[model samples]
Target: MKYLSLLLFLVSITIAGQNDAIAKDYYNKGEFEKALHEYKKLYAQSSSNINYINQIVSTYQQLEQYDEAETFLLNILERINYPAFFVELGYNFQLKNEPEKANTYYNKALASIDVNPNHVFGIARLFQSHSLLEEAITAYNKAKALKPDFNFNLQMAQIYGEQGDLEKMFTSYIEFAVSSPIALNNVKRAINDFITEDSTNDNNIILRKILLKKLQEDPNLLWNKLLSWLFIQQKDFKKAFAQEKAIFNRESESLSGLEELALIALNDGQEDIALEIFTYLINTAQDIDTQLSAHHNILLLRTKLSNKEDFPNIKAQYNKIFEQYGKLPQTLDLQISYAHFLAFYDDKPEAAAQVLDHALDLPLNALQEAKVKLELGDILLLQEKFNKALIYFSQIQRNLKNSTISQEARFKVAKASYYKGDFKWAESQLNILKSSTSQLIANDALELKLLISDNKYEDSTQTALKLYAKADLLAFQNKKEESIIWLDKILKGHKTEPIVAQALYKQGQLFEEQSHYEGAITNYELIITNYRDGILVDDALFHLANIYIKQFNEPEKAKALLEQIIFNHADSIYFVDARKQYRALRGDAIK
Candidate 1:
């Protein structure tokens, strides 16, 4: 029996050694589940071993078993004076959504004399992960007090930055820079993030002050770069320009700083500053793309600052561009813009026409030709030469078949005819255009068509009551002008007509349309004087008040008219507007 017991003990020792080796191998490979199974068997046999207990806790944590991990850690804390065990317990409670229990354990861990720095860090990470930022910051500070290291400080600074606490972030970054000079990149990134996230101008100013102080203390390249950014954000272009110039002077070239400075000036409306920086880029930047961008921006800024009287200078700039790049396909855009400028600003429509005519003579493509023709038509329209305008518009219409430009040209043709008082031809054109594919063009065409159709019907009033039915149709169509015109003809040709009062009231509306305020007032007075019992008397009085208030701008006259309408025509349809206007003119503050 003794010999058998010795052999079993030797076999058991060999198995335990093999299990330890397997557990270490799995732990090193990060196969935590396999490592846990091996460690669990060893821990079951040797429960008092602190390393075994720790491995079990770690495996439970790896598996996200918060309750198991917390129970194992509490058991270790009860037997051994392991300060870090309390922190692990705190983390487990936090993972279980028990913040109060986590806080209790964290305070206990912090009170220990032999506390591990990792424990403090764990507590900080737990609070930060749970979004308890203020508490996290306090824990992070405690961790830093225990171990003043780069990793802990960086984590604390990042947490403060996430909370948008600029002051704390800046302080931490500055301390980091002073301790580890190689971490200047980190400092720059932190400051940039703080400035970008800050919305208020005052906050920006505060950040600038902090950065400038850092620059004054640390005369490093990173500090200078940060100063340049600060100046750009504050729109102090002169300072930014000087800083970038100093940097490039010391180094060979720094196109990035110059590009950023130019963009900043452009955004702040500092044209001269932008021009200065762009000129520097054109002269010094070796890249063709950078030089081209600089030249383009300089020209754009100059164009924006030039006025109409500076057309000669503007023309000279375009001429220089065409002289240099006339053979290139891209010059066409410049030609188009220059032509438009000559037509509108220089008041040189003939010159504009000649420019476009020359473009047409070139080997132009279809789209280019269509654009030029549209511009030529616009110039003619502005010159008030309707016949000439129609010629260009018609060309675009024929060339750009079934396109939006064709629809636009048809609308312009109708507009030109209407301007020339050719109502019949204009109405025909508008009727066709009313069905255009473009909604805006169709709406305008429909409105003009209605105007012409109603006007002709109203003008065909030979007899007094002959077109009464037509006038009613006009009213229904909201053709206020034609309805009033036919009504006026009736009042003059058939004064004894039964609809005389209605006609007189409509005549008041026509006078109002023509902005003849006194004429409208006189017609309304006729309605009140001659047809007091007429149903339109109340309407006439109400419209008279509107004419006085709106057309004539006579507040007192409007006030009296409204009061009269309210007193004599209380049941009129215009009672609402009249009462509102009356109260407003009386200074009653009507909304």
Candidate 2:
């Protein structure tokens, strides 16, 4: 009887080892189906062995047999009472998009845990996946209460920021800073964002004061990052300069604070202060990247402060940058910007055209060629050389048919026609362009169509006026080049009558039609100052305000004009629009 029992035990051990070998071999060979079969047979024989059960469950889950995995896990949980197993089951359910089932298993896991931080974190992550942010935050708080850690606090702060709960976000960051002083950089970034977003709010001011007070209590906490932020917010750029100087003097750290100070000064319109910082950065920065950035910003500031007399030096500097970095592909953006500056600011359209011509001739792909051609067209159009502009526009139109460049090219075609005095041809092109896929293009087209069609009926006095009106009407109907001829005839006649105001208004409207907001504003301001009693005065004022708001982003100036229309010309039909605009500018909610 003993010998029989020994033989049976030997057979059982051989079968168990064979099953284990089969399962591992299949798994390692990527034969998941075969591995699952082997694991299941072994799991059935050794039901009490949690390792065997886990293997079977994992194999089943890998095959996406969720029901089978769940059944096996639940059976084990009933016998072993393992919360970690339940958490695994929850994740499997989540993978299957069965949120309710996932939540049930997660809750079950939570019930088994006395205070398991890992289980809490898993639950929080699940809630976060579903965008149940408040629930996630609560669960994260539970995990933190059990054990405050860096990762958990960082996650909590990020979640609050995503929800735009700035106060909570700041507080969480502060908590993280208290726990780990190395996280002070994160705290400074959060505080900066909070103050910027709520610049006018008393709460923001108080929070800043509290942060300053905390820093004062521990002067050692006054790092370069914190000092840069504090001085920037207070607009005490001189102090920011000193702090950056101190950082470099004491620690040999690079003067990164100077970049921040320069940006802040530039934003506050303290151009001289910005220039001072950039000059310092240019001299001090050892990295090539930092030096180039400083030089670029300094040049931009110089351009902003320049008059016509300063253009030659600025142009020379731009040329020097191109000569130094022009071979690098990374400098393409700087090249394009410099080209645009020459075209618009220096009024050297030919120079702009030449730069873009060179860019087009480089080892560029089709997309780059198309972009350069579109910009070349814009420069030529700005210089009032319509026929030369058409060549570039047509090239983009033919080459990049379905691209954004093609759409922009088509719009410019109509604009070039308008500039050449072909109102009829411009209008026809604009009418088709009004249905463009690009919203900006469509809006410009529609606005041009309206200006042409609305003003034609009002031009009836001078014979030249009648002809120009006829040409504009034809342009509206799509006879662009013909319309240009009519406008030319009107200009040749130079009839000094009410019709002249109409002609000037049409000229200004043409500029506006081209998205040349500065030119449009100039022309509109001329009409307002020169032809104040003319019929288009109210229209000019309305459009001038629009240019300030939409193009210049000067809401204060826009608001003033809107209010002026409501106060000075109450009976004008633009009064209602002006009031709504005023309310919008004042940050009032529209019904």
Candidate 3:
């Protein structure tokens, strides 16, 4: 008997829901008479359902029966204490051109809020729905005045924003964020629409002024953090770093925020501020990990900016760090970084491999040991010991099956095979890795696979491909100059070949590595002009645009080039970055 009753309740609910959908469908299709008939039946079955009441009134109005809507609202208002019904009645009378009656009903809705302040929400939403902005604002203000505990700042902020009053909007949003810190990120997302990449934009200046005034008055860390975020959005890394510093001093808390700020500045090419932040971390960080990370990045930045003339000095800096820290287990990552510097920067792969060999002797976990072996394999590959590198990579793959690091090792195995001209095994490995869990590894595998497959048919002997692989291997060995020369040979010998575009891109990268900006631009421009339909066209365009921005100080040209990728090559891997840079260059207000 209980089961039968439950089943009957469910069946009735399904029938009612279907009836509701049918009424809504009829109303949407402009069959208002039919909609009104169905709504009346539903309202008769459930007289307490406010939704059915509202729909019946709306269907009456839709069918030009405003008097009927007024009658129904009046009859229902006594049974339901819905202040919003007064607004709806006012709307119905106004639709019938009874202005004085409409005003009376609107005033009645506003007055109902005083009797119960919670009625303000429904009344204000109804007023706003009818485009009655002033009435809505007045209702919210009246409720707030009557009840001191009411917080309508978020609603007020949206209204003020819609009204083009940014000052009030920003102030209300700030107040809302302060009152409910949990919604702080949501508030930031809301306000970010008005902010742009331009630091000197008037909206940005206004937001800054507001944030700064709050900072002066309250001395709250949230204000400073918001100020920092605002500065970051404006690309004002120096000011952002200062705010981060103030927050750090006040909280004396974790260095994670400061670390993130440093990386942000670094990524945006604010190298000096990043270096300062890193130096500060290295000096103030209490933990060994933070200090090691700071030291690691500082050395990396210095090496990247250094020429061969500065190589020995960078090595001495590394040695000084080791002398101070004594190559302990905590310093294992630093050791691996140092090995990479030695191999890739200092022309000492053999010495780099020896460092990792010593590191392998240390007692480490599987992940730590795998990390060391991965770098070791890369170094061995740089030294042309492809089989030896594969030994390490294969071990990592076997031990950590299906892990991200294992997939990375698998990718490396394929790459090493490609560099050694073992195309068949490399192709097999790449085909498997095309669906890797790591997108970066999968992308790399697919590109290498395409490069091998595209050129394999053009030459029966694979002579040109072998030379290209040799050039690639040379570049991996940090022999950028030799790599460029070999790529030139491929360009000369295989001028009509499909691999020419790849050769040009590789040579352009080598040129950029050597700071030969014009040579890089020339090669990249060639690819853009001749290979507009090719896979590397987006890459060429992006790289060329970057050179224009970073090297030539010609953002207009960069903007134009990036626009091509935005409109033409939307599927390209560089499309997102191109759109972002393009928008920044164009000073787009949209975030």
Candidate 4:
């Protein structure tokens, strides 16, 4: 008898759950009549189920039966004496356009809050549901006043933002951040919606003024963090750095946050501010590792800012850092960066090779050894030492067979063979690397393989293709002027070849590098005019539009070109970026 009774109870519970689910589904599908029927049955079986009661009331309102909803709530209120029913009754009256009756119940709901502060959340939610934002705010304020420890700033900030009262929104978010330090990122994300890349934007100006006033009033550390964030959004790295300094002093925190900020500045192309921040880190860092990293980054910054005339001084700086730090495993990145600088910028391949070889003599792991060898192989290839370069690349492939570095080394081998005009050997290696684990390497291998296969049959001698490959290698070696000359040679001779479009595109890039916008425009126009059906048309359009937008300040012309890409080349790889840029140039808010 006991086992049979247990089974019966289990079956009853399952049936009840199914009925509730059916009611919810009907409600969601807008079959309020069916939902109301189902919910009423459930409420009869379990009179204490508040969810079922709420659903029944909501379904009645959805079906435009306001009197039914109010009658049900009033019956519940008479039996249970719950204060929230007043809010439901008020909302129903408001829905019926009975403002006097609605306000009476709304005041009753507010009056109940004084006796019990916990009633505020549900009452405010009910008011907000009916679009009574002012009443909702009043209810929330009353609750906060009754309960001194409550935190309602986040809710208030959201409401203020919805009302388009940005100053109040900013202040409310700041208040929330002060009370809850861990939610700083969440607050910043909310603030980002109102600001833009331009600091002079009205919202940005308003936020800056609010933060400045907050700091003047109390000098809180939160204000400094917010100011730093705002300045970064504006690309004002110098001002951001000042704010970071204030935060560091006020909180006595580590330099890690400031280090990350400096990296942001560097990546944004603010060399002066980045250099200043890095110099500060180097001077103030107590640990040897941090100091070394700061010094290495300083060298990198100087390298980027260095001209040909400044190479000697930059080389001396690299030597000074090397002499101070020595060739330890911790300093490996600095060594590789220095070697690259020597070979590429200083034009001293032999010297660079010697430097990396010495670093390889240190007690290093396999990855470290592979890193040095990769740089060494690159230097050798740059100097046209193909046999030696192939030897180093093959060693890495043999040692780290399935590693990303191994795949990269294999790609390098294929490129080296291509540079030497050994097409068959290059194609073999490229075929193997077309499925590399590294997407970049795979893409490069596929492009190179296509280039070789596409043109190898065009000319029995492959003379023009060979010249084009050499020109590409020259561009890779930073010899842009020479690369342009070689590309012109291909253009002048192979006017009708399939490779001419690529040649023109390459020359366009080189012209842009040299700041010859008109020359770049001419080449890109040729590709678009004569080779519109070719693979380079979308590339030409995007680059041409970028030049017009950024360098020439002709946004209307840029927009026209970008639109061509959006409409004509819908399946092109540049489609998404082109559409985004088009919207941004049209002053659309970037969401």
Winner by lDDT: 3
- For candidate 3, what is the lDDT? 0.90
| lDDT values, one for every candidate | 0.71, 0.71, 0.90, 0.89
For every candidate in turn, the CA RMSD to the true structure comes to 19.6, 15.6, 3.1, 4.6
Question: What is the lDDT, from 0 to 100, of the residue 564 in candidate 3?
Answer: 94
Q: For model 1, how does the per-residue alpha-carbon lDDT over 381-498 read when each residue is reduced to its tens digit? A: 6676779989988888888876877888887777666655566787888888878888888877885675556444444442443354346445533355777777767777767655
Q: Which ten residues in a row have the lowest lDDT in candidate 4?
A: 582-591
lDDT for predicted candidate 4 compared with the true structure: 0.89
* lDDT of model 1, residue 484: 71
Off by over 4 Å in 4: 1-63, 75-85, 251-253, 397-404, 417-468, 486-506, 522-546, 555-591
Which lDDT tens digits does candidate 3 get at residues 186-289? 99999988877778667787888999998888899999999999988877888888888898898987888889988898888888889999999999999989
lDDT digits (tens) for residues 71-137 of candidate 2: 7777777897556676668777887899898778767755543456776755566566656677677
TM-score of 3: 0.90
The candidate that wins on TM-score is 3
lDDT of 1 at 209: 77
Query: Against the true structure, candidate 1 has what lDDT?
Result: 0.71
Clashing pairs in 4: none
